[model samples]
Target: MTTTTAIGYENNLPTNDPASLIERTIDVPALGAHDLLVEVRAVSVNPVDVKLRAGAHAGGFRVLGFDAAGIVREVGDAVTLFAPGDEVFYAGSIDRPGTNQRLHGVDERIVGRKPRSLSFADAAALPLTAITAWETLFDRFALTPDDTGTLLVIGATGGVGSVMLQLAEALLPGVTVIATASDPERAAWVRELGAEHTVDHHGDLAAQVLSLAPGGVDWLFTAHSEGQIGLYSQIVRPFGQITAIDDGPRDIAPLKAKSITWHWKLMFTRPLHQTPDLIEQHRLLDTVAGLVDDSRLRTTTTRTLTPINAATLREAHELVETGRTLGKIVLHDGN
Candidate 1:
C-alpha cells in the first residue's frame, strides 16, 4: 500500500482557531488511464481552498488545495503529454482529491510543463490564478492586442488580480488597465504589475472609474461581482463585457439597460465537467509558462511556508480568510 503525507480536515471549522486542519498519511490510489501521478513539490492556497475547507464535510477527511507544481513520478498508460521525471504545474480538478498531499493524481489534459525559469514554489502560485485570468481576459472577454479599450479590474492586488494585470499588459496592447485597490500598498502593487491607474474599491468605485473614463470602462473583470454588481453595471460602458471569476448568485438584471454581456470565468469548469476543450487548459498553461520564461508574466507568490503540514496550511488559510492577502501563499515540501 502506497501512502503520502496530506493535510486534511474531518470538519469545517474556522481557520482562526488553528485546530481546523490536521496532518495524516493517506492512501494514494492507482492512476486512471489518462492520469499522471505527481510528486507535489509545492502547493498554493486560493480562496477556493478556504471555501471548500469551511464547507460541510461530505464524509471522511477532505484534503483541499488546487494549485501545484511538481515532478511526475508515474503516468497511466494513456498519458502522453507528460511522463516520469517531467516537471509540471496545474490546477487540479475540483471534484477529485486535491493537491495538498505529497502525491497527487491529476489528468494530463489539465496540466502543463512548468516554466523553466521559475522555482517550484513560484510555479505553484501561477496555475490557478493564471488560468482564471487567462480565461477571463482572452476567452470570456475576448480582449485582443488589436482592440483598444479601457479595462476596469476590481480587487486588483490579490492572486488573480496580480496575474490579470500582467496578462492584460502582455496580451492586450493599447489598452489602459485601471485597477481598484483600497490601500496605498495594494495600489502600488497593482501599478507595479501594469495597472495604469488605481482606484479605491471601498470608496466610490463608479465615480473613481468615471474620473478616468468618463464614458465608463469598455470592459470589466471583477472577483467581487456579487457584492459590487450594481457598481459594475453603472461603471461599465454600454455593450461592454463583464467576467466575474468569483462564485455567483449575481443579479444581472441591472445589466439589461446597457445591453452588457456578463460571463463567469470558472477555471475548473473544463476539468470538472470533462469538457471536450479540456486540452485548452493545458495549452493555455503552456502559453503561461512560456510567458513566464519570457518575463511577460510574473509569479504572484508573495510568501512561502516550509514543510507542508497542518499548522502551515492552517496558517495559510488564516491569511486567505483575512481577505487582504496581496498575492499567493505557497507551501513547499519540507524535504
Candidate 2:
C-alpha cells in the first residue's frame, strides 16, 4: 500500500562493484492469501544470496535474502497460523521478492515462531541452513531417532553443516557425527557444535574416514559433491547414502559400485513448487526453535553487521564469497 527502503540489485555485477547492490524505495509488499506481512528485523546472508546476485533477475531487478527474523505486521485472509504481533523466522522462496526489505510477505506455511531465547540477528541465521540440513536428514536420508550409525559431514563449519552437526547429536544420539574441518580452529568449532570426530577434508579423506570408522560411514553429507563424489563413494559403506547441496555435474557412476545413494537438495524445492507438504518447513523451524530454547541447538551466527543497508549487505556477500566463514552472518535493522 505504501513504500519502504530495501537493498537490491538492478544488474548482476561483482560483489565489489558499486552498483552490485543499492538502496531503493519499494512498495511495502501487499499480502497474498496465506501470507504474513512481516516487519523484518534482521536478515542473514547465504551462499545462495551471492549466487543469485551474480545472475540477472527476469524483471531486471531483484531483492536478495532468504533467512530472516521479524515481527508479523499483518496477515492475509487465508492465514490462520500467525497473528499481527507474532515473532517469526523463515527462509523465503526463490520465486519471491526476498527478505532484504523492511516489510516482506511470506507464506505462513513456510514460516515458524522465532526462537524465544535468541536475538533476532541470531535467529535470522538459522532458517535457510537449518531447513537444508533438516530436509536432508529427515526427508532424504530418512534418519530416525533410533538409527545408530556413523555420519560424515564435509564442510562442517559452515551454516548448514554447523547446524546439522548439532541436530544429529540431539536427534540421533546413537549416531556419531564425524565432521571435516580443514584447520584446528575449525575442528574446535565443529567439536563445540557436537561433532564427535574431526577430519581434514583437504587430506586423504578415505584414510581419515576409515581410521575413524573401519567400515566407512553409513551416511555422508557433502557440500562439494562434484569435487569429492569419488572419494565419498570410497569412504561410505555399501548401501550408504549421501545428500549434497553442491551445484555441479556429479558423476554418480562411482557410487553404483557400492550402491551408495546420492541425493541432492536445494531447500527451495518445496516453496518453489508450492508442494502440498511444504508446511513441513514450518514444523521443522518450530522444532529447531524448541531445540534452541532447550539448549540442544545453537544459532550458527558468527558475525552481525548493523543497519541492514546496501553497504553492509555488500560486505556480507563478500564474506560469503570467500567460502571460509565459520558460521552465518546476520544484518540487523539497527532499531
Candidate 3:
C-alpha cells in the first residue's frame, strides 16, 4: 500500500500566475501489478512542464514534472526489478500525474537505480537529458560506440547538449566533437564537457562549421532553435544525419539538396504512446547510471532551489524561458 500526498494545481491554468499552483493533498491509488511507489526527493524543471501548465486543456488539476530522483517506498506484487527502499531515478510518463508531489506511482519498466555516487539533486537532472542524447545518437542516427567521425552539437551548453557532448566523448572514441555556444562562458563550459572544438552560434553557422570541418560534419544534433534546420543541412556531409528535438515551422527542403537525412527525436514519444519498446527507456537509464557511478558520465545540474513550491518553481521557469540557462534547474524538498 502507498499513501498519497502531493502538491499540485487544482485546475488547468498558467503556473506563472501565483494562484495556479494550489497546494493540496490527494490520495494516490494503490500500485498496479507493475508499478512502483516512489517518494520523490528532488525534481527538475524543463520546457515541457512550462508549456503544459500554460496550455489549454481539460479543466482538471494535473501534475507537471517529468524528471525525478527518489526512494522506492513500495512495489507491486509482480515487480522484480525493484523493491521497497531502493533508490531510483526516472522521467515519468507525460500521460500521468508527475513527480512534483511528495510521492509518485511510476512504472518500473522506465525507472533505473540511482547512481551510487550522485546526490538526488544531480540524479534528477540526468534522466530526461540522458535519454534524449542516447536515443538521438544510437537509435536515430545509428552512431555506433566505435564510430569515428566529426560530430556537431548545436546549443552545446543546454540540458541535452551538455549530456550529449559527454556521451559522444565517452561512447564514441576518437570522434571529434564540434559544439556551438554563442557566448564565451558557454563555449568554455562545452569545451570542459569534452567538445573538441567550439563555435559561436550568433554568427554565420554554416561558415563557422565549414571553417572547422572543410568536408562537412558526419552528424549534427540540434538542441536549440528549430529555425536552423536549413542551416544545419547546408553544413552536414552528404548522407549525413541531422537530428532535432525542438519543433517549429521551418522549411526542410534544404536537406534534399545535400541528400542529408533529417531525424526527429522526441524523448517522450515512447512513454507517451506506450510503444512496444517502452522498456528501452529502462535499459538506457540503467546504463547511464552505471556510467555515472563509474565516473564516466557527469550530471548537468547547474542550479538548485530549496523547498519546492509555486514561487520557486516559477523562478525556475523564468530561468528556462530566458533562453540562457547553461544546464538544468532543480527544485527539491516539499515546503
Candidate 4:
C-alpha cells in the first residue's frame, strides 16, 4: 500500500436520510509531529458509532469508527512510542476522525502495541471495550487490581461487560463476580469468561444478587439500562461503588438513600476534551497489551466482515443496535 489506498465509509447527509451512504476518495492528513500514520487492517463497530450516525448533525462526510488494529506505516518526527512497521491497536479519539479507513492518522498517546498473541481482527475488538472497562473499574470506581470484594456486573455479556468480567477475574483474584444476563446463552457466555455466577436481569436483580452473596454486593458495574439505577442501589451495600457506562435520564435518588457511590464511565471524555491526563489512555492501553501478550487476557472479537465499506458497516451497525451481540464485531481490509 502506498501512502493511500485507504477504504472507508462517508456519510454526507444525516444518518436518517437515505443518501447518507455516499462514498468517496479523500486524502487523510499527513502525520503530525506527534502522530502515526497507520495502515488499518481491521476495525470494530460500537454502539456510539450507530448513535452518532443516527443523530441529526451527522454531517461533513464524517468518517465514523473507533476501534482499530493495524500496522504503523509512518511515524512523525516527535513520535517515540512506535516506529514505522510497528503493529498497533487503539480506540481512536471520538473528537477526531476515526479509523474506518484503510489509512488512519492517530496520535501516539492513544495507541498501543498490538498483542503478539492475537490476530489483527482480534486485537481490533479490544481497544475500545478494554479502555471502557479499565477506566470504569480502576479510574471511576477506584478499585485496585487486588480488591477481593464481590462485584456485580450488570449486563455482563455485552461488549464492555464481557471485557470487564475478564479483567476483574484476571486482576482481582478471589473476588466473587456476579454477572447479570437476560437469557440462558448470554448467561453461559459470561460464565465462560470467568464470571462466578450469572443472574437474569429481567428478574428481580436485588433478590437474585442477594441469593448469591446474602450480603449486598460490594461493587456494581452496569453496562445496561440506566433506568435500572434504583435496582443497583438496592443490590449494592452501603458505601459501595456503582459505576455505569450508560447515559441516563433516570433518577439516582435510590442510590443517594443507600449512600451508594455513583460514577459514570464515558471512555471518550478524556480524549474528546483533551484533558490533561489524556495520556493515561495510552498507558492503560499499553498495560492491556501486556496483559494480552502475556495471555492474562483475551481479545473479544466475535464477528468479522469482509472488506471495509458502507454496506458492510451498516450491517455491523445494525447488529450492535440489536442489543444482543455477545462480543465485538469487526471489519477487516479483506487482505
Candidate 5:
C-alpha cells in the first residue's frame, strides 16, 4: 500500500472534543537502514500519550502512541534480526511519529519477537510498560538475583508497577516487594502480581511501612511523586536509592538527611538519545517474550477495544486520564 490510515491530532485539545483525534490517510513512512515497516495490529495507551496530546502543538496532525504489536511487512537493508512476516512488538521512539497508524516504521533495534503464547492485543500491553519496568529495575535500580532487600513501589496497580512486580518475581529471587495500593481491589491485585506486602497509599504510608519494616525500605520506586517526597523520606533507609518514571518528588530537602540517591528513568531516553546501548531494548523485549512463552510472566492487559479509529483513540485517552485504570488499555484494527 502507498498510504495507510491513521488516527492523530492537529492541536492540543481536551480529549472530550471531537477534534482531539482524527482519522486520515497518509503516505507510508520512509525507512532508515535499521527501520522495519510494520503492519500494526494492536496498540496500548500510556500516560505519555495523554500528556503529549494536551501539550503538543504540531503544525500538522501528530500521531500519538508508543506501544505496538505487529507483523513485519518490510525490512531495511541493514536489518538482520527480523524480516517480512515476523511477529513483533515494540515501543516507538519519542522523536518519531509513533505507532498509531495502520503502517508504522520503527527501528529494528527496539523491536522484539512477540511472545508466541500471546495474541497481538495482549502483546501490545507489554512493550512500553515492560520496557519502563525493566529499565527501572535492572538499569536504574541495578538489581540482580543475588540482591536481598525491600523494594517499595508506589502506584503498584498501574501498568509499570504491575509488570515490575512480575519481573521481580521471575528475576529477583532474593528481593521482597512492598507495593502501595489505594484500596482493597488494588491491594489484592498487586499481591497477585507478587508484591509481598501492600500498603494503602491513602493511609499512613510511613507508619504502615515502618510496621512492615522497622528500618525502612532499601529502595523506593514511585510512578507519581509530585508532593510525596516528605512521606518517602520518612520510610526509606539511609543511603537508599530511588527511581521515578514520573515527575518524581517535589522537594528533596527532607530526603537529604538520609543521603538518598534519586534517579529518573524514561524508557524513551535511550532511543531518543540514540545511545550506544539502544539495542538493549531489543534484547530485553526478546527476553521478556521468552518469559511470557515460558509462563513465568504474563501480559497486564486489563481491557481491550476493537477497530482502532478516531473515536476509539479519544475514548482510550480519556480512560487513561481518569487515573483509576488498573492496568493497560489496548486497541486493535481487528485484522
Candidate 6:
C-alpha cells in the first residue's frame, strides 16, 4: 500500500488554531488519464484556502492548498506536456485534492514548466497570484502592452496586488500605475514592485487617485473591494474598465451610469467549470515562467518555512487571516 503524509482538516473550523489542522497518512489515489503525480516540494497559502476552510467538507478530511512547485514523479498515459522528472509549478483545481500533501495528482493541462532560475519555494508563490493577475489584466480587461493608459491599483501590497503591479509594469509599456498601500512599509514594497506612485488605501482613495490622475484612471484593479465599489466607479474614467478578484456580493450599480466596464476574475473558473479552455492556464503559467526566467518579473515570496507540516500550515493560515501580509508565504519540504 502506498501512503503519503498530508495535513488536513476533518471539519470546518472558524479559526486557524493549531488544532484545526492535523497530520495524517493517507493512501495515494490512482491517477486519472490526464493526471500528473507531483512530488510536492513547496506550497503557498492563499485567501481561498481560508475561505474554503469555513465550509470544508464534514465527511472526510479536506486538504487545502492551491499553489505548488515540485517535480513530476509520474504522469498519466494521456499526458503530453509533462513527464516523469520534469520540474513544474501549478495552481491545482478547486474540485480536486490540493497540493498540501507530500504527493498530489493534478491535470497536465493546468500545469507549467517551472522557471529554471527559481527554487521550489519561490516558484510556489507565483502560480495562484500570477494566474489571477494575468487573467484579470489580459482576459478580463483586454489590456495589451501597447495600450497607453493609466491604472489605479487598490490594496497594492497583498498577494494579488503585488503580482498585478509587477505584471502591469512589465506588460503594459506606456501605462502609469498608481497603487494604494496603507503603511510606509507596504507602500515601499509596491514601489519596489514597479508601482509608479503610491497612495494610502486607508486615506481618501478617490481623492488621492484623483490627485494623481485628475481625468480619472483608464483601468482600476482592486485587491480588496468590500466597500469601495463606489469609489472605484468614481475614480475610473467613463467607458474605462475595472477588474477585481475579491469574493463577496458587491453592488456594481454605481458604474452603470458611466457605462464603465467591470469584470470579476476568479482564477479557478476554468478548472471549476471544466471549461474547454482549461489548457489556457497551462499556457498562461508557461508564459509567466518564461517572463520570470528572462528577468522581466520576480517571485513575490516574502517568507518561507522549512519542511511542510500541520503546525506551520496553521501559522501560515493565521498570517493570511490577518489580511495584512505582504507578497506571499511559502512552505518548503524537499524530496
TM-scores for every candidate against the unseen true structure = 0.97, 0.98, 0.94, 0.93, 0.98, 0.96
Worst ten-residue run, lDDT, model 3?
1-10
Better of 1 and 5 by TM-score: 5
What are the per-residue Cα lDDT tens digits for candidate 6 across 1-335? 39998888887775645658888899886799999999999999998998787665646888889999999998898999998999999999988888899889999999999999999999999999999999988899888878888988877888888888889888897889998888888888999999999988778878898999998899988777777778877899999998878763458898898899888888999989989999999999999999999999999999998779988888888889898899999999752
Which is the better candidate, 4 or 6, if ranked by lDDT?
Answer: 6
lDDT of 5 by residue, 247-306 (tens): 765668888999988988889998899999989999999999999999999999999898
List candidate 2 stretches off by more than 4 Å: none
Between prediction 4 and prediction 6, which has the larger TM-score?
Answer: 6
- Per lDDT, the best of the predicted structures is 5
Residue by residue across 127-236, what tens digits does model 2's lDDT show? 99999999999999999999999999988999999999999988998899999999989999999999999999788889989999999899999887776767877899
lDDT score for residue 302 of model 5: 95
| Better lDDT candidate (2, 6) | 2
After superposition, which runs of candidate 6 have C-alpha atoms over 4 Å from their true positions? 14-16
Residues 1-335 of candidate 3 have per-residue lDDT tens digits of 34455555655555467766666667775788889989999999988776676664624667778999999988999899998999999999877888888879899989999999999999999998899999998999888866888999987898999999999888898689999888888989999999999998888888999999998999998866467766776789998988888774367887887888888888888878888998899999999999998899989999999888777877787688777998999888741
lDDT by candidate, in order shown: 0.90, 0.91, 0.85, 0.82, 0.92, 0.88
Residue lDDT tens for model 4, 1-335: 43444333344344344355445566766878889998889999998887777663645567778999999988899998999899999999877777877789899988988988888989999999999999888888777766778988877887898999989888878588998888888888899898999898788877889999786899888766557776676788888888877776367788787788888788888878878987898899899999988888887878899887777787787788788888889998663
lDDT score of model 6?
0.88
- The better-scoring model by TM-score among 1 and 3 is 1
Go through the candidates in order and give the clash count of each: 0, 0, 0, 0, 0, 0
Q: List runs of model 1 lying over 4 Å from the truth.
A: none
RMSD of each: 1.3, 1.1, 2.0, 2.4, 1.0, 1.5
Candidate 3 steric clashes: 0
Instruction: State the TM-score for model 1.
Output: 0.97
> TM-score ranking from best to worst?
5, 2, 1, 6, 3, 4
